[model samples]
Target: MTIQTVAKQLTRTTKYRLNNGHHIPVAGFGVYLLPPAETFDLVYEALLQGYRHIDSAVIYGNQKEAAQAIAQFVKDHENVSREDIWFTTKIWNVDHGYDETKKAVEKIALEVKESIEYVDLILVHSPLTNKEKRLGTWKALSEFNHNPNNGVLQVRSIGVSNYGKKHIEEILAIDGPVVVPAINQLELHPWLPRTELREYLTKKGIVIEAYSPLTQGRHLNDPELLELEHKYKIPKAEILLKWSYLQGFVVLAKTSKKERIKLNFEVLPEGQGTNDPLQEGSNLGKIDLDPNILDALDKPDSHLVFTWGGADPTEYED
Candidate 1:
């Protein structure tokens, strides 16, 4: 099907309700490569720029900064409460066992200076670790969902990142009742659309989070993307962001620049007024790309994973 045929309305207030009943904002600010020292300020700036979702990880070593920013932002904005923001973090590969994973979550809560209830989501960073360890980690996350002792909810939902179909199947086949993953964050762009994995997750009702949506700014100048940029009069980055939005995936855009942070949230068509792209009736809500352009962009070409290479779970299969 052509992209326009499937494209849906896009708004800054757009959200995807998880199977668990919690809602996640469609557009999130990801703090992947930001220095830990700069994370607090950058994240706080994004929050001020109308971003309510913040993606961080233990491996990224900026969970504390993100947490601090969230707390500070909520304090500053009277209308905004802790529940208004969605915070997501991941368990590092080193802490993959049941007890270790539990402790890891506790550490995150402590570092963030918020109770478990404040943390919206936690994910297994990847499936690169051994199978036993991976399952054990998931078990710990499941326990938190069931028992929130001392008024600490631990985490509202659990998910995985960079997991292929095999990894998901293994989790579903665990020996006993286990909490199904609610989301899977992956490096997705037109070049590496990962159509197979996307379809598999769609059938299972697992939400997909698109990371590195801009391909690390490498393909911004591509002739095809440039054409769309010119046609829509929007920046190449917005075109990429809109593509993922059109496909119904939560997109994570990372940038430290204040102006870019604000621009990233503005996806409305030209002349719609820049004050608020999320305003109703903005043409930016829907995108219509040519069928041939969609095919060229969505077709899998040479593998181009910018963040995690040689870490695909399928590659570990015997």
Candidate 2:
């Protein structure tokens, strides 16, 4: 289909304002593989196509280009300021801790190019076994939040990744309220639903961000998903992204191609059953799939495992 047709069907803003009072576009575009040079135009096109939120990372190795693209977009469009953009990046595992988290933000801000000092959200890439160190890192994030003088070094919202209920409770149960983690980035898909985790976070008023909703193409070959893909007349990838949408999570999907990105953004109306979710054995409440099915997917025969980073997703028993 034509770009015009795709744009026409683009439904509600995939972006969502998080519980922390910060906003994120519902469907943020990403550039995980493009070199810095190529990323500039890809990001520019994504923003021009109505993607306000951009997802990048230091490890992804293209923040320089991504930032350049955002800068050029603002320069070309006089009315679009840096505030018009929602940017997200993660702190690498090596940088978790109070001081490192702060410096990480400082580093990302430098790459963002535009005059804006800080990105919208910065998360601890994943759970760290080093308990005391992780606490220090969170402490650093809190310092960033409470500091008014740290412009550009200041991050609007701070949170964790691949975290579980235990991890959050550990922090929150501490003396006085701490920085509430705004979103928990996790792997989510119809085949591997996070029902308990979602329910727990919902109670805490935290948003769940889904990363590998398409299971990095692992689910594409599933008998159930394939059947629904054919029935909906939508590509399987779109079906995967949409399934995450139906679960009420902010989904980040990546594509350098305008066509693929557009298709990823086309969401079906809620309750439309576009993926035929009603198929037997698809329900999370029933399926007994191993939680570590991801490792199996990464087996030699399976495709590459697509992952950004973990904040925290708790399968905490309700």
Model 1 residue runs over 4 Å out of place are 1-6, 115-117, 150-153, 268-296, 310-314
Best by lDDT: 1
What does the lDDT read for residue 318 in candidate 1? 34
lDDT of each residue in 188-307, candidate 1, tens digit only:
888778888888887787888999889887777778788776776767887787777766678999997889998888752222111111222223344544434544456465456766
Full-model lDDT, candidate 2: 0.64
lDDT tens digits, residues 1-318, model 2?
221222222244534546767766666776767677778888898888767778777788887777778878888999888888877777777887677767777778777735445667777766754666678778887777777467756678877777777777877866777888887877666655656766787778777777767776655887656666566465678656655555556677877677776566554331111111111112122111222322222222322333433222342222
Off by over 4 Å in 2: 1-10, 113-115, 268-318
* Lowest lDDT 10-residue stretch of candidate 1: 270-279
The CA lDDT at 301 in model 2 is 30
lDDT of 2 at 186: 72
